[model samples]
Target: MMLGSSNAAVDHPTSNVTAFIRRANSIMRQLSSATLHKFVVKFPLLRGDADHLDRWVSLSAASRARRIVLDLCPEVEKFGDKNQMYSFPLHLFTGGSCVGGNPCVKSLYLGFVSLNLLPLAAGGSTTTSGFTNLKQLTLHKVSIVGDLQSLLPECAVLEWLSLTYCSLHCHDLIIRQPLEQLRYLRVLQCRLQKLQLQAPNLTEFEFTNQQVPLVLGDCINMSMASVELLLLSDDFDYICTKLPVALPHVRDRLTVGTAIRTEALVLTKAGAVFANLRHLILNVTIHGCPQASTGVLRLAYLLDLAPVLEELELHMYCVSAPGFPRNPRDLDAMATSPPARLHERLRIVHMTGFHGSRGQLELAHRILWSTAALDRLIMIIGPRIKVDYYFRNLTFADTGRLVARRYIQDQFPGTVITVL
Candidate 1:
C-alpha cells in the first residue's frame, strides 16, 4: 500500500510512504559532473571586502574540487591579514598584488608581482611550509631580494620552474635541495650575473639576455638530449665570451642573431662550436664588411662547421660602396664552394633581403650550382630593389628572356625557385 498521504496534520506520511519514498529517490538522483575538475576565481577589482571574502572562503573550503586558481588584485596596503579568506587544497594559485598576512594558499603561480625586502621580511615566518604538493611554478616580473636558497628548499616537489624579467643580487642560484624530479626550467630577461643549476632530470631550457659575462657555471651538468638557445647582442665579442661555457650540451637546433661586427673572430668561433647542429638559423648584419670578402669567408666557415646541417635560414644585410666590386667570381667563391666535408643533408635554403644585384645574383648562381640535392630555394627580394630593372639590365645568354630568368633556368634546372 502507498504510505505517504496528503494530510497536513500528519507528522510523518504513512498511507503512501513506500511509493512516495521511491518517487523522491528517483527525483533526487545525483547529477553528472564535468571531467575538467578545476576552479578559477579572477577578481581584477577585488578590494577584499570582509563579507565577500568570507563567502569565497566558505565556498572554497566546502568544494571537493581537484584544482583551484585564484587571481586576486586588491589595494597594496590591504594585503596584511594573516588569515586567508579561503582555504582549500588547491593545486595552483596565481596571485597579483601582495597578501599582507601569510594566506593558507600554498601552491603559487606568481605573475607581474615583485616581492620587496619588507614583504619578504614580513612573510618570513610563513616559511612556505604548506607548499609541499606544489609541482609547477612561474615567476614573471618578480624580484627576489633574499637568498633563493631559503625559498627553494620549501618547494621540495617542485618539478617545473620559470623566471622572467626578474632581478636577483645573489652570486649564484644553487638549487641545493634535491630537484631530482624537476624537468623543465626557463629563465628570460633576468639580471642574474651568474647562475648554477644542479637538477639532473631537466629536459628543456631557454635563456635570453643582454647582460655581458652571463656565466652559467657547471649548473646544467645533467645529460640533456634536446635544447634550444637564442643569443641576441650588438657585440659579437660579448656573445663569444659567454657561449663557450654556457652551452656545453649538444643541441639538435641552434638559432643565433648578432649585430654587425667588422671582426670575423666571433662568427668563426660560433661556426666552430655549433657545426654538429641539425638546424641552424643565422640573422647577421654585414654592414661594415663592405668588401664582401670578409662576409663570404665567414659564411664559408659557418657552413663548414655544420656538417650534418639540414635546414639553413640566412637573413643578410649588405651595404654597398662605390669601389666595392660586384663580381660574379667573388659571389661564386663565397656561395658555391664550401668545405668538402659539408653536410649533403642540406635540403632547404631560405634567403631574405634578396636584391637581385650582381653580387646577390652571383651568390644565388653559386648556391644553385653547388647544392645539387637542394629541394627548395626561396629568395625573398627586398621591396627597395626594382625586379624589372634587375631582369632588363643584367646580361643573359640563350633564349631572349630577362637576365634573371635565363640565369635561373641555367643554374637551378631541377629545383623550384620562387621570387616573392
Candidate 2:
C-alpha cells in the first residue's frame, strides 16, 4: 500500500494534504484487519496533523506490516527543532499491543522523524521484543536521540543497517556486542567522531563523511569496502597505515576516494598487503603539470601493496589553474629506478580522464611494462570540461587516442587496447 504526494505531485493544482489524508483514512478503514505485507506513506506533515500521523502508524502496526516506509518529510528541510517533527511511536510495537503481540516488522525506512530509544527500556534488559525480527532499517534525516548502541542489540537479526543525514552530533558509535547476521552497513553524512563495530558476517561496508577513526573488528567475511572522505596530502600517511587495520579482512575489492590535493603523495607502509584483493579502484584529482606527474607516480605504491590484483581502475581528474606548466612534457621525468615487472597476475587496467599528459603516460607505461598477464587496456580519453579550463594542450584527447592505438598496441602485442 502506497499513499502520499511526491515532489512532483506537490506542484499539481489538485494536490491537497487534508483531502489526501481523509481519503487515505477512508481507504485504511476498508483495510480493517487485513494484513499488510508492505506499507509506504509519504506526505508533507505538520505539527497540527499529529492525530492523522499517529492513526497511520497505528493502523500499519496493527495490520502486521512487514515492510514500512515513512517519508513525511517537509518539502523544505527546515524543521526548527525536534519537537516540530513527528516522534515515531516505537514503544507501542515494543509493548506487543501492535501486530497482535507479534512484532512482524522486518524492514523499516524512516525519514524526517525523531527516534528516541530511551522509552523502549534498557537495551536487552526487558526483552528483544521490538525490532527483534527486523532485518533491515534505514533512517534518513532522522533525529536520533539517546544511545544507538542500546538499540542495536534489540535488532539481533539485522542484516542491513544504514544511517544517512541523521543528526548525531559527533557521536562515538561503538558496538560492544557482535552482530552475527549483519552483512551490509553504510553510514553517510552523520557527524560521527569514531566508528567501532564488530559484525563478523558483514561482507560489504561503506562510509562517507569527515575523516574519523574506523574500527571494524575482524570482519573476516568482508569482501568489499568503500571509504570516501575529505582528505589532505598530510592524511596520505594515515590512509596507508590505518585503513588496512580498519577493514583488515577485505578480500575481494577496495575503493578509496580523497579530495584533490597537489602535495607530494606516497604510501609510507609497503608491508601491508591485500593478498586476496582482485580489484582496486582509485578516484583522485590532480593539479596541473607541476605536481601532477609526481602526485600520480606515487600511486605505484598502491599497486605494490595489492600484488595479486587482477583489475585496476583510475578515475583521474586534472584541474588547470594559474602557474600551470605551459608544456606538460617538461614536467615528466623518469623514476630514479627502472620500472619493475612485478604485476604478473594483473590482467585488466581501465582509466578515465586520460589527457595524454606526461604523468598519465608514465603510469600507463609502468603498468604495461609490469603486468605480463594483462589482457585489456581501456583508456577513456577526455577531460572534465568544468575543471580543466585551460589545458596546455587542449588536443590531449587526440594525443591520448594516438598513443593508445600505436604505442600500447605495438608494445603489448597480445593485450587488447581500447581508447575512447
Candidate 3:
C-alpha cells in the first residue's frame, strides 16, 4: 500500500516522494495501514535528507511490512567507496513491540548503506525479534564486524544469503542454525580468514575467496559446488630451460593413437587433487612457471592428479612480467615421461592463447598421442605482436600460431579440430 501504482511500484520508490506519500496516505485511509506491506525505498540522489528517510523507515515499521528493500546513495552514480554512503538507522528496524511499534518485516535487503553494529546490542538486532522471521537476506557493500555472528542465529528460516563485496572483519565466519532453511549461499570477495558452514541440507554453494579456508561441515544434500581461486598476477620466475624433446620424436605409423613415449617426468610436488572432478578449466600465466617451456610440463602434472577428467581447458596469459632470467636445465629437466598409459576418460581438449611454442607443442603431442577417446581438439590463437620482441628465434616467427594450427590439423585428421 505504501507503493502507490503498479507502474510506480518498487522501481520508482523516490520519484516525487511527496506525491507518492500523499497517495500512500490516501491508500492507508481506505485500506488501513495495518494491511500496508512490501515497500521499497530506493533513492539514488536523495542528498541531505536523513529526516525524511528516517521517518519513512519508522512509518514502514509501523505498517509491519513483510518485505522491505532500502537502497540509498548520496550521489546518483558513485558507489560506497567512491562516495559517502547513506547510513540506515538500525534502531528503526526494531519490531513495533520492541520500541512500542509494529514493523515486522520478513525479507530485508540493504545496499550501499551502513549498519554500525557497535554501541548497539550484541548481534545488533537484539532489541526486537525483527529479523527472526526472515526467509532471505542480501547485503551489498556493507561493512560489518561481529554483527553477523550475533544476527544470523535469529533468522531461523533464512534460506538464501548473498554477500558481495562486503568488508567482513573476522577470523572465523561460522554459519549454523536458525539458518536451518539455508539452502543457497554465495560469498564473494569477503576477505575472511576462514568460513565454516554447518547447513545440512545446503543444496548449492558458490564461494570465491582468495585468502580464506573454507570448511563445509555437514552439507549432505550439496549436489554442486564451485570454488574459484582469485588468481592475481604475481612476480614470476621465467628461467630459460631446454624445451621438452619427445623421445619417440616422430609419430609412428603403426602406433599413431598410442601414448606418446617420453622420459620420466619428476612430477611437480603433489597437492590435494579432486578425484571426482570431471571437468577442469585452468588459467596459467606464462611466466608463472620456473621456465617458459615448463608451462606445459606444469599442466601435465595437473592431468596426472585428475584421472577422471573428461574436458580440459587451458588458458594462457602473460602481463610482460619481469622474471629471473637464468639458465637452469637440470631443474627444468624433470624426467617427464608422458604417461605411457593412455587415459581413456580424457576426451576433449581446448587450449587458449596458443602461440605454438615448442613446449606447448610438446604438450599437444602428448595429449593427442596419449589420449585414446579424444573427440575434439580446439586451439585458440592469442593477441599478435612482434615476434622478435619475446624471442629472437625466427623458427617461431609468424608461424607460431600457424604451426599450432597445422600440427593439430595434421595429427587429428579424423577427429574434429576447431581453430579460433
Find the number of clashing residue pairs for candidate 3.
12
Report the error of model 3 at residue 296, Å. 4.3
Best candidate according to TM-score: 2
TM-score order, best first, reads 2, 3, 1
Off by over 4 Å in 3: 1-37, 45-48, 73-84, 91-104, 118-128, 176-178, 218-220, 223-228, 231-272, 283-285, 288-291, 321-342, 375-400
What would the TM-score be for candidate 1 when compared with the true structure? 0.56
TM-score, candidate number 2: 0.84
Is candidate 1 or 3 superior in lDDT? 3
lDDT (0-100) at residue 201 of candidate 2? 91
Better of 1 and 2 by TM-score: 2
User: Per-candidate TM vs. native?
Assistant: 0.56, 0.84, 0.67
Native-referenced Cα lDDT, model 1: 0.45
State in Å the error of residue 149, model 3.
Answer: 1.5
RMSD value for candidate 2: 4.1
lDDT string, candidate 2, 22-133, tens digits = 8889988898778889999987675567798888888888888899999867765454355677888876677374535667889999988888766335444533357778
For residues 196-302, write the lDDT of model 1, one tens digit per residue: 65666665566655444433334344332222223422454444445545554435655665554333443536422543456666555445544434333345444
Worst 10 residues of 3 by lDDT: 250-259
